[model samples]
Target chain A: MRKGDELPPLEIPITRTLIVAGAIASRDYQDVHHDPELARQKGSPDIFMNILTTNGLVGRYITDHFGPRTVLRKVAIRLGAPNYPGDTMVLTGTIEALEDTSATVRIVGTNGIGNHVTGTVTFSMRDAE
Target chain B: MGDDPDTPPPRPDFYDPDDSAARPKPHGANDSTAPGPRDPDAVAARPQSGDTGGPAVRPLAGDTDHQTPRPHAHHPPDDLLTRLKAYEGHPAAVAGVGKDPVNLPMIRHWCEALGDANPVYTGPGAVAPPTMLQAWTMGGLTGHTGRSSAYDELLALLDESGCTSVVATDCEQEYLQPLRPGDRITFDTVIESVSDRKTTKLGTGHFVTTRTDVRVGETLVGTHRFRILKYAPAQRKKPPARPQRPRPVVNRDNAGFWEGVEQHRLLLQRCTSCATLRFPWLPGCAHCGGPDWDTVEASGEGTVHSYVVMHHPPFPAFDPPYAVVLVELAEGVRMISNVVGTPYDKVRIGMPVRLVFRTYDGDLTLPVFRAAAEEAAV
Candidate 1:
């Protein structure tokens, strides 16, 4: 695999429930993350996912695709635009390099409005029975 | 300029509105004489105001039209987001050290077993050994037995597949002071870098390097650079043989000096009576044999009083071509310590030296001397 090769799309729909759930799980109490009114008061368009939540979700998507036998060696990701509720974020991973038993994958997540997060993930895989 | 009294000063045309203050004075004006409200034509030429307060509002004919454009809040860019995300995963694993806690009692036991008798460790000043402070704070050894630290938990999550083993190898520490008991130190550990290495068994495994910074409150106590190798099981190999070095025996009189060496401080015994400075610090003065002696802190800056290059040391830990020097400090004191940071051939008597802390076995802190440039005369 090399750079610019697009992988299969992993769709995760953004919702108020998921945003709140993630905020709770990560213990992020910043009101702009889960309260739309507070977010607007803070001059944002709407409530959005916290950076940590976005990171955890992106990792979850990659690990899910790679399966349990795959070991996630490393992941580097950056959060971009705010992911608003009701937006469907499409998570995509492209194989950047495959050497020996290890592969480097570039994962990107984008809503229809704009890109939300992009990262590079490395994994070592074993043959499945 | 005189006009008839009945002329009423030509009845300034207030109704004609050329001077009427109520007829929409130039929008930003506090008085009619000021420039009329900013030109409507110019306002129309600019971008339209959005509901989210995109454009600054111009005051209209009434006060109700006042509006202020709110600025957008700055959010982290995609690149920072990506780096932070990548940091969430565990670092590659190395060998030699595991994630088990180095408990406080265990550390105390290690210090006692090693025979360190500093009051800072045993008596009223019984502070935790400075280097051992990191293990007590962040090594998952404090408080609970089975619980892992924040970094350790992340490492466990990364290695859930169990394909690799994590090991810690290198550590660099700078001691500002000793850590007394009951001081809770916090740690921020990050996966510095990761790479792949050749596999001896089957396929390639991962090599992870982590930089764990340990701090007490806001003061940085030490930094540990841990290198781990994660790979499958390999064939059994023979253990490497150990090298030996001359071990200097320590008596009660010289014990404090060696302890100072282990603490990375240069300590010397100064006689209060004859003012004689002695090395290998003894409890009694060498000149007067007076028992009135006190510890003096050495600046660790000195001149090489004498030297030797050992090429025939048969110990596994003692490598050949290393210089051991007797340095005469500025205070008229002398000490025997290894000279580092200079070529073996460059070493000479009277060469200026500075002290440095060296870590052996990832635990013992040893103070050694290295060459330093002489200061220019003022």
Candidate 2:
């Protein structure tokens, strides 16, 4: 991977199953991600994706693009808008800089509302063939 | 303006010690002025001689009875934030070591729990999920006993300031290498930073961040940054509404478990081929990969394998300072549930428990385990 190379956008359909499954998988028991009514009570329109889910998705995106050999060094993302069910989140990233064996990738995940997540991911490419 | 015309003026005898005309004498039997036994430990001696039971019901370690004890105090100490900040860069966990090697069984359990069907996580030559980074570092059922003293001191200070409740805010992780089976991991964590005083909907407290570096042998493999808010639970103007427990997500693979629960039967999935029982319900057996399975109704007998007293980020549905346990069933599968009918701290490993179906809210019934010791005593 070289600086300025943009990763292909990954489109994921947000489903209730995905929201709840992701929340459960991450060991996060927060209700806003699983219960629509609870989410509403907490000032959201519907059940939304959790930060861990977003992080997992981002990890999947980078690993898929960089191949199995690419090792994730860091994933630092801050959540913004909520990714509610029935919406599609498209994650895209561009290589921000390149070091000897690693590259800094700036990623932004957007949905119908706006940017749901934005952050930087560092990957070590030493094991790449 | 000094005194209203309708108000009676202060009596001349108001300041007199013998002023029975101005004030009634103390009359309660406990208010007697005659000196009784001056024993300092009098109150402590009042309990029955056989009350070993008192300690059995003592509050769990992390139980912060915030709302009942200090309902009127909303803000933490003014210097608490500063003192917490002084702990920045201090060791939170040291000489931390992973008890079990990064193995397939744990990775498999994680995938099953999350309903993750990632092909790479299974079969031979499989790698553990990257997100399993923290799981590998967890202290398991008994807990991580390698926590440093400074971390305990900081928590004690936070507790003293009435910022006794805490909830994990978020975590950021970076993986440098893929973890495979047999890879032993070790980690060391340091206090990263402490945020200034802030008021969240939960309450007013500081956000503490700890950074952990995970290594395999000598190679640094990952870095995990976890943040938690230690705050006083917010006081409601009116009695707070009891929140409903979030319903479990039942999918095709695990629907049988919930169905069994509805029938008041605690079912453990037993692989028909290997006869190995498993829990949290799985479609296939981890031991033999047998897709066909049957259910075994548990005898409702088990022992607490491990437990934690949840006392942070108080949730509406859950009472803080409650003990959540990992129980090893008599049939040999482990499941996570709340330990009831005993003090959170008193729920110890190896304590016997019996399953009971409880209606959490008016609507939902869950299989909860109560301490068998308490049952026998009653």
Candidate 3:
């Protein structure tokens, strides 16, 4: 991948199952990520997506776009709007810089309310030759 | 799935809304507090939640029946805090032992759930993930939490004081040694601190922190510090129209498979070049770069390969205590879906299941499986 190359945007439909599945899978037992009633009691309108799930999804996006051959070296992200159930998160990546076999991608995942996650993913691909 | 052209049908699609409806029933699972249809046999058969493998973990704190406002509002903050403070630095659990020794099955399950592929977790001389420090001590749902009566009394006091809603605020762990299979685990916990009444965006409550020291045969393996916020649930928003179930994204490659579902057919892709059978409609064969493929119908016969029951964080759209299962078809392929006909706990590994189409929210339709073998009741 070269600087300025754009990876196709992946649209993820944020579902309740996916949210809960993602949180549990990460071993994060935070209820705000899964329980709606508790979430409301805590001031949230509903359960929201945890950061690890967003990180996992971003990694999946990069691997899917760069082909499975790429190795994800690092993921640095800052969460913004919370991804609530029934919303959709559209992830778009742009290669901000490239050096040797490694590429740095700028990723933004936005949901109905606003940008849920923004970060940089750096990955390295092996040369087929 | 009935066409029978010699190739097996497709596995249920994960993205399909209809597939998400299989609700797991709570029997011995500690992850959920929701009551659902259950069987006595299941309770006897299944290990308490927190067993090493599938569907084991769920949020722990704030799992109680406190939605209704307590007639007596707010216990005096000073009194509650004073009583809560009395437990500080007290031993909550001592000589607590793990249900199972550190083993590969649990490690494998943890890796698979998180999609972690680090080489250190598997193969020869593999060590369990260091992050699994706390899991080793959660003794199963058989009321073996290894807690001292004081700790139990402390939580009971908090519950009685009306802090119903819970959210885990933070966790800190320090790994001193790597845990491996065959190693026995032991731990001790102390009530580290309980904070005074505090207000945050989520609500107003006190913060409870517990520190645990985990050991493998006297070798200090790790230390886990956990904190949670127990707040009186705020009733700011009226429960809205139960949120509709989540929908799937249908693209060109998987469109035919969904269309087949619409027609009550489960279709599998038969690669034209290599003639390999593939579940979950994909564009090309991984076996060969074959560009084209056709469809085949499944026999609607499969066995449960594995499963996890969801009991916590009940969603508005989906009910708690449902089973999300992985089944291996007779054709040697696997897919994920919810099991409908039996209680979530009743579903077991190697049990037979047959495919059936289900619709949710009055409009969404997808394929689900019902236990094919006759239940003891049936």
Candidate 4:
């Protein structure tokens, strides 16, 4: 149980389309993000999302919950494990501190297998009517 | 608490387009109106030409569809070849070139100071690391060691000319042979071109591209291209605040000092035998290898010995324009600290400063130094 927590568990379906899109969007041309054989050569279990992709996905998940009105003030993240295609990532956030107009949320992203990325996000919100 | 907690509100009209406060125009609505062409809001709302539209597109300002012209797409092969050949015989120039080969001992000492033990550098089997070459080249170890290399001398020249902002924007290098210890390499650099660009916060400056060629005897080893942006003074944006890190607890070997620092005191270890003060919080003094020492509180006042305004944040807890300073304190103990409370342009060698403690997350305290006087004599 955490303070200022309202959103439910967000399950982001990981797909090859999303992985490829994320890689191309970040200008990361690493084949491991798209080609399975290249990823295998690099000692990965399979084609996996890159750091930038993981960051984008996690940012997107939080923003979707808060809606377009919220602005992301800061995000600090550390990559723990890899997120491969076909693994659904569940992004969970716990409000660590709450102010009159803002809140600091500790967001942890994990797949069914294990945790992938852990980070703290500080965001500002409009007053509740 | 007389008001009802829960109440049903009146239903709003569905087709009320005249409600003045219902909706505001989209963001960037007043960006521009004298348009030869315009993108409709509906089209703009849709993600264009990339994936993960939220964070990615927001940072990039240029045309998304502007295709990067191929290396030689527009120019004829002969013309490209001619330009390449013209550059072949021309001497190579590097930006921020130094006078000596980075004082090898100094580099090793700096790495050790950071408490990093990456074997590729310190191990017996370690070859010249790729990064070491870049560092060495900047410290001016390319060729002649008698005077500051052409690039170092150029910076001095530029500084004397009153150029306020000097920034290294792009660095591209091709490594042919791995550099090894004891390899004396000679390098010559030439200014290829300098062009004016739009003014940034640092100031209105020009982009200078220098080509550097490294040679071992008559054999060509490698080439480096360096681009630096120099600007004049202007209003600078305040860097974003860094996230907090948990403080590490101090014990017997370091206890009296951690407690003092928590109380905003600058404490140093003084040797009992030689009366020498050691920095970086080591176990013993480097001068006499004396284990017996006494705790001394520093006044936290010093003069800047040398400094660098890092545009690139090296750690997660720092931002750009952060000055990494080497201060010669009154006690003669030069310690490394981040200089705050002054414009980046105002920092200079021999500038007086006083220590200030910045508490982070209510636990960790960082001893940052700030200018001591009202106005820094530029």
CA lDDT for candidate 4:
0.54
Regions more than 4 Å wrong, model 2? A13-16, A27-51, A81-88, A111-116, A126-129, B1-77, B108-123, B139-143, B148-172, B199-204, B229-378
Provide TM-scores for the models: 0.29, 0.48, 0.43, 0.29
- CA lDDT of each candidate? 0.53, 0.70, 0.68, 0.54
lDDT of 3 by residue, A44-70 (tens): 778987755676677667766766356
How would you encode candidate 4's per-residue C-alpha lDDT over A17-109 as one tens digit per residue? 777765554444567778875664444446776655565555555556776445455454554445687888888877766667666666677
DockQ of each: 0.01, 0.10, 0.05, 0.02
Give lDDT tens digits, candidate 1, residues A39-112.
74444457887654565565456556665455445445444456788898998877766778787666667886
List, residue by residue over B225-271, the lDDT tens digit for candidate 1: 54444444333343333423445578888888778877777787888
How do the residues B1-378 of candidate 3 rate in per-residue lDDT, one tens digit apiece? 122222221211111122233222222222222221123332333233344232322222343233332232243444355456545665577789887888888777666654556665688878776556666676534544566765676677777777766655444456567788988989988777777666554455677888889888878877877666677654546455467888889999899989988999888899999989998878889899898999888877888999999887676688778999998887777889888989988989988988889999898898888888763346
What tens digits encode model 2's per-residue C-alpha lDDT throughout B1-378?
A: 123322322221211123123222111112111221223233223332124221111111222233133232233332244345445556678879987899988777666544456667778888887877877777644667667766776677777777776655556788878899999999988777666656665566667888899999899988999877677665655544555779889899988888888989998889999999888787789999999998889999999999988886467677667898999999888999988788887889999999999887676879999989788888
Interface RMSD to the true structure, each candidate: 29.6, 21.2, 14.9, 21.9
- Which candidate model has the greater TM-score, 2 or 4? 2
What is the number of backbone collisions in each predicted candidate, taken in the order shown?
23, 4, 6, 9
Chain A superposition TM-score per model: 0.87, 0.95, 0.96, 0.87
Candidates sorted by DockQ, descending order? 2, 3, 4, 1
Displacement of the residue B365 alpha carbon in candidate 2, Å: 33
lDDT of 4 at B107: 38
Candidate 2's TM-score on the B chain: 0.45
